[model samples]
Target: MTDEDRYELLGEIGRGAGGVIYRARDRDLGRDVAFKLLRREGSTLDARVRFVAEAQIPAQLEHPNIIPIHDVGRTRDGSLFYVMKLVQGQTLKEHLNGRTSRSELLFAMLQVARGIAFAHHRGVIHRDLKPSNVMIGLFGEVLILDWGLARPTRGLSTARDEHGGTMTLDGDVLGSLGYMAPEQARGEVHRQGPPTDVHAFGGVLYELLTGRPPRHSRTLGELIPRLNELPEPAPGPLGALASRCLAPEPGARPQSGEELLALLERVT
Candidate 1:
């Protein structure tokens, strides 16, 4: 068989800002896999750096809730790509196409928190955690999918973080604007830490409860002001939890993913 024939691309299953995913079969392994490739050929330095960086993060992480990457390499045509398990269900965004009850929302957020906790313990931070980055299995498994925006938190960021994960050097930002933490939005990359992810996690929880991002704002200019004085969320304890997570100051927020998850349990 030809080198290009190793994987039989079935069809395009999903597409996003990062890349396009295809449902394919590993002919030699006799199994199905989700193969992802950048939408462009990654010819530029930024694209090439991201192509390798994204694959390395997931490959290094080992968690039940994190998607496992099987292989990463260049295609016969020299385009970069990676292979991962094909989750049967849809993203948290798609799963929430209809209204969700408080209990169900809390349950999913708990799983998301737990996954982030696992990553945090390992010194990795998911700089971009959102509903679209989460995958729910047919049997109710929650898997954190993309690690493209993840990075080590022990030191000041370097060129890669600035270009790939952090706000761009020129003031452009990263991640979903509606879910971005204030520090991320302000381009204060040095201030990001575990709480940064916690802030995004809170934003996710807010969306889970209210069906929109915190304050329903979709742009950085709109989100930053509201971050300092977020409108009160739903009528009870979960509302309090959301507020704590979205605290404008990183230090004021829940210190870790585990701390946030614990608070969620106590409140709910």
Candidate 2:
């Protein structure tokens, strides 16, 4: 049986620029899973490589806060697909819709920091970090999702495909606008590192404390100049930390997710 035959697609969960994710059932195991299939049409070669790396990278990480990949294969139609645990919960963005408990929000953000710390320990960096990418399960479990932009931090600064071609070219900006670190917004791919995610962690925390993101700019150009102009967060330690994370210089922020986790632990 082929990869597609082994799983039954129940319905589509969502769609993104790279591909669509479906709710599927594993025929052999009789278990429900999330099947992400790459877009066959209009997908560039770089996107394809990143899609495959997304699956491969997370599979190597066995952290409780990170989504786990169950299987990966190509469909009979030649489309790349991967199966992962089907988490039942709303994203942190959605979860914060009607919630206002500071402690609860801090707990969720702490879990996200733990996950990112583990990935950094494994020599990988999550270039994209935002509340939307964080899922809070029905049982209060926090899991980080969508690692399609992750890259190794060992020897190279920028990610490269098997053929050694740069996957994220210089000046090829990626990541969400408000959550992006200043270096990321400028498309300084080489400057991206653990500090990059720390900046985003601050943005997430700022949004949790305030109703909006740290930066209110609607476009990259608008955001660049106003990167340092952050709205005041909740009046406390958490708020203070958020401001530190949003510092324009990467050195001014926590050096890594590990450092961020440590700092967050001090917040009561």
Candidate 3:
């Protein structure tokens, strides 16, 4: 059978600026999978380059906590698509809707840190690290999702689009505001590194403890100055770690996810 007939699209499970994810059945494997298809309308060459990177990057990261890409191809109409394991669970953002135990939340966050640590070790930096980008599976599995904004620390920083134009320029602002690091907020892409993701992990931890993001501003202008102005977290080891992770200066925070994971392991 042709690539078009190999998977039958069932329904859309998620949609983003670059692509749409559908619940599809792999005819050959007879299993349900997530089929992420690059959107056609308004899909610029840069967006297409990023979409391909999003799939290719994670496909190389073979970790239990990172979603696995089974196959990637284009439809008969020429829209790019990739198949991945269909997770049966809510996003960490949705899971946080109910009052979760502090221990349970920390455990989940620890798992996220582990996954991120592995990615960092592999030289991949997940520029966007937020609760919504995390998945909590039905059996207590935590998987990191969305590698579109991820950059490599050890390789060429920029990607080439179809027209040979640079896909991601240094000054292009990316990532969510509330969880974004100071350098990231300033669009200083050159300064983003493991510490960037560490800063976001701290934001995630702060939200878990307080049910709110570290920053409350509605605009980048209002948020940039106040990025360092986080209220006191609850008193304890975890709280102390959160404060350190959210430190305004990158040097003040954990250098990498591995360091953050080590620190978190000490919290009782």
What is candidate 2's lDDT per residue for 5-42, written digit by digit as tens?
99999999999986899999999999999999995677
**Each model's C-alpha lDDT?**
0.78, 0.85, 0.84
lDDT of 1: 0.78
Q: For candidate 1, lDDT tens digit of each residue in 85-147?
A: 899987888766755566665677778888889888878888888888898888888899887
Candidate 2 ranges beyond 4 A from true positions? 155-160, 166-172
Task: Please tell me which model should have the higher lDDT, number 1 or number 2.
Answer: 2
lDDT of 2: 0.85
Task: Give the lDDT of residue 114 in candidate 1.
Answer: 85
| Residue range 71-124, candidate 3, lDDT tens digits | 888888778888888999888898777766777777889899999999899888
Q: Score every model by TM-score.
A: 0.88, 0.94, 0.93
